[model samples]
Target: MTTASPADELALLTRLRRDLHRIPELDFDLPETLRYVCGELEALCDDVTARYGKDACTVFSPCKSSLCMFFDRKSEHATAVRSDMDALPVTEKSGAEYASCHQGHMHACGHDGHMAMVLGLAHHLAESFDELPRSVLLVFQPAEETTGGARFICESGVFERYGVDRIFGFHLWPDLAMGEVASRPGPLLAATSESTFDFHGKATHIAKAADGADSLEAGMRFVLDAYGYMAEQAKAEPCLLKFGLLQSGQARNVISSHTHIEGSLRTYSDTMTVTAKQHLAELAESRAAEAGCTCTVHFSEGYPPVVNDEALFDLARAALPDLHELPEPLLIGEDFAFYQRHLPGVFLLLGTGTGIPLHADTFDFDERILAAGLETYKKLVRIP
Candidate 1:
């Protein structure tokens, strides 16, 4: 097999990214996307396994797509690299020639770039399989934008079956300059929990305000109290609590019988998340009682914080020249955190410098920067 030159690798990545970008599929139901990715991997990998619905036997048994590729050199342990496969629901507005051909879905989160980089690595590895110091596993995960797909992958027992020792993954970031790589040693991304509060009360005419219990008033009070509580907690440790939706009242003349509050809480530690949720629930219950209303609270245990292994991070920093060390962690959540719980893993950020935030309809980047990400992965898998 002949090795690809730098120019040839870049061209391959550009073509792959554009082709995947055109087919932008959503959470777990990726038919065409799965076919495209699996075809590419099967061509270059020594063994390619495609897991579909009910095959993995995980909680997400309905998940229709995920791929795992292996290059076995008879090494005792393997290095794993992951790339998420799902795209956002936003319509294409970037106006690029290779923009999403799917009408309502788009690769607004750079999953296209990620897939291209990992596939490029696979191609490179196939050319020099005998030269590798250890075996490697390439993971293509789905439903990262909705349900936590990494958790499903972990529960599938593939890592233990393959003897994976360490894993690495990357996300394209628009905050830093193009081609710059950035990460922190610990708590690189926040753990997230989705919260919902429902307040129940009586409804009456506006003219007779005393006849009805005000659920809206109770909900508003809880919001204000939760904000103050979160603000106080942030002084000691970084955390966030914010509401995006608050709906109450059906008409102008009547008091609302129900008020719904939806929001998310972000924290670095599980203890902090528990404490915050307890306080929020207390506040909601008390405010509702004071307003002569009833309340219910629900919290979904979302993905854990992406905490990088300090030893692995040191190894990466020393190996990659363009790698930048971040002083603080970002509040964004990632499913990649799930992999870190089982074994050593490092989540990296590659700069796009496009000024277009992820998940936006207009989010896009120069395909040339994908070559930088490809190089980073190439260097990571070869680390001694």
Candidate 2:
């Protein structure tokens, strides 16, 4: 098959990455991003189709802008590659000329690079479509930064339609040196669940503290109880509880009537997630009762833990041998777990050299590191 050299491919990917970086879009409704991605797919794939999630029930809002591009669709078995299309809410401070033109939104997670590498793979595969043994599906998923678009695409019946046999995905990591890649057989990332606690109490003048229920006190008790619960759970298993926002009354003279606590929970095991969440709910109820207040727990169902298929990891290790085995599982979460749950798949990480971490205002990576990702995708495409 005729294809561009590695250097030329990297050059093309760099240009595309820059163009995408300039027009960063947020979750779900990415009209401009969708247009640009479809344009690229038109030039490379055999058949390009767009899919949408369930409607919003009221008000015609733009649904997820997901695209599925095919190459050699007649093959009985197909392999899928996913690239998330959403950007974070951080403003771009990366002094690069291709910095985000959309103020207050930026591709600080290297998703632009991810899209470019996948697009490059599409181009490379299109050049050799006749010789390819299996079909290929290029998934451009939106809203990875917020609601998971992967689940929506999966439920949309693309997998059944394409007869997908296996899938692969990767994320660029700035923690590792350039050219380094890492993955393990099981539990590469943690199962994550987010929660918000709303503590309610009777509001009254501070001078009459005995007559009023103090929500601020209830909130503090809940926090302490949560930490205690997390610590106890950690004794038996690995778990993390992080509190990001704690808010209470606006006036000091008034006894606080309401308080809100926002935090996230992470664990490597589904069992642990259940236990931790149960304990948290119980703790909130018990503490609220003791503090003479009411507590409501609002939990956001989150992505499952990313567990690599052991057999697929073998293929990955053989196809790309230079990978380093990760010492332990990561606390972060990935929606790629949704795909892994459906079929044998692997989620690999590419090192982009150390610097500002992902999601930071200054997050950016060297364009050359994309070569490692491109090479890996090329190798995976050839797997039988």
Models 1 onward score TM values of: 0.93, 0.90
Q: What tens-digit string does per-residue lDDT give for candidate 2 at 295-314?
A: 89977889999999999889
RMSD of each: 4.6, 5.6
lDDT of 2 at 37: 84
Best of the candidates, lDDT: 1
- Misplaced by over 4 Å in model 2 are 46-64, 204-208, 250-254
Q: Model 1 clash tally? A: 0
Please report the TM-score between candidate 1 and the true structure: 0.93
| Backbone N/Cα/C clashes per model | 0, 0
For candidate 2, the 10 contiguous residues with the lowest summed lDDT are 52-61
Model 2: lDDT of residue 285: 83
lDDT tens digits, residues 34-105, model 1?
889888876554332222222211111222488887777668898999999899999999889999999999
